[model samples]
Target: MKRFLSGFLIGTAATVAAAASVVLTVKKQVIDPIDEQQVAHDEKRKRAMRKSAAR
Candidate 1:
């Protein structure tokens, strides 16, 4: 019973740590760049539309 409890606690800690790491990595690697790129893309599209409207 003691061994089982210890193993369960270890597994839970490992899973939580791994999840936090993945979330942090994804925020930096995937989410941040996508948000930046989307904002830039939207601004570019807006400028193009404005230019066409002016003409």
Candidate 2:
């Protein structure tokens, strides 16, 4: 019984650690500075083009 409990605890801890690492990686990708800036610049250019076309 003791051995089973120890194994279970270790497994649980490892799973939690892996999950935390995955979450951190995803968060970093979502908040990347270069991508965010590029997206903003692209949006501005599109808006400017639309306005020019309307003229």
Best by TM-score: 1
TM-score of each: 0.74, 0.57
What residue runs in model 1 are displaced by over 4 Å at the alpha carbon?
Answer: none
Candidate 2 lDDT by residue in tens digits, 1-55: 9999999999999999999999889878776767899999999999999999999
Clashing pairs in 1: none
lDDT tens digits by residue: candidate 1, 1-55: 9999999999999999999999999999999999999999999999999999999
Q: Report lDDT per candidate.
A: 1.00, 0.94
Q: After superposition, how far is residue 14 of candidate 1 from its true place, in Å?
A: 2.1
Specify the highest-lDDT model's number.
1
| Cα RMSD for candidates in order | 1.6, 3.4
What candidate 2 gets wrong by more than 4 Å, as runs, is: 33-35, 38-55
